[model samples]
Target: MANPTRRLEESESEGFVISGKDIGLRMKALEYWKCAELGLQSNPNCAVQSFKVVIAEALPNQGPNQIDTFLSEHGGPGIQHIGLHTSSMSGTIKKLKLHGVEFAEPPATYYSEVGRLHDILGVGQDVQELKELGILIDTEEEGECSKSPRYLLQKFTKPLFDRDTFFLEIIQRIGATGFGSGNITALWRSVQAYMNEKHHPEKS
Candidate 1:
């Protein structure tokens, strides 16, 4: 499914693709991710400035599959996460935090390093603002340009279910349409830390 709709006066769209491949189709599995990147770029945005959500799931108890891991914990193949885009990630995060939504926050060191790249990367928001709001920034290279048009910000909500299967992504795109590939590792670590802190503080 792919269609743009209004989200609180902001343009939004959601695209979904499900494959029933069994384990061992490693190459095929990656196609889903690649397809998602294409989906985000191709989603129409005529009515308003657009945002996108990509939803994916696992087939069954596939080995080492994150989607399957979600299914295992959640009792079925279900929503792994929901990505919501915003123009003002700082303000949006602030409001959500005030409303008691927990998010995975990167450490000060992450922001410190990111700040050093601001000039070269042409980031749109202040490092301090992003750090305070627990937002992560990512930059994509466009053709021969030294830096991309705009950076992306993202934060993941604490899992809504006790089993840690589902969560929300608060996202903002300054100019880029693709997801933040650069932020994946840091975001994963942040999520792992958050999960450990919440589910097993002793392990943290």
Candidate 2:
């Protein structure tokens, strides 16, 4: 489902607080897809709405792995990757790999730490299964607003097409509404390592 967590009918002002300082953030207008309108009369009393959140961030200097480089190489900025949700990550990964799909393998050091994390919060799936499938796991601690902790597992398909622009992600979230922030950095570094080994850019 193409869901948007936030919607803006008009331009709005927003910023972030970094190191106790307010920093202005850049906002971009992304192209939107048209959907068939629901022909039901809107109810003002019922206060509930659903949407999706598109996360954005600034890229490091003009490196081979930078977003600007990607945009310059590809025609323009588009869907960098698509994340697919699944209930059984291990099964999905096995099936996809059997069909000749290659995935980026996170470093062994990353898994070494997973064992420690598993002790405090239960592992979502079998640790060995995740290792064999090269799946990454992330968890969110329960807070005042949330009653129970959550878990997430994800694996990314290697870049498709010659330009290495678009790719796919297989994800499974348990009691989690937000994407795993920890997974983002871990997976990104792993993907770059994979790219370096396969593509081997002289400078990045």
Model 2 residue runs over 4 Å out of place are 1-55, 59-66, 114-116, 119-121, 143-147, 201-204
Q: Model 2: per-residue lDDT, tens digit, 37-64?
A: 4433344322123233344544333234
lDDT tens digits by residue: candidate 1, 1-204: 111111121123323222222221111111233345445464444314433444443334444445555667889766667778787888898899899998877755666563335632465467566667777877655546544566678898877877887888888776665545445445655766776687788876
Can you give the TM-score per candidate against the true fold? 0.63, 0.66
Candidate-wise lDDT, in order: 0.59, 0.60
TM-score of 1: 0.63
* The candidate that achieves the highest TM-score relative to the unseen native structure: 2
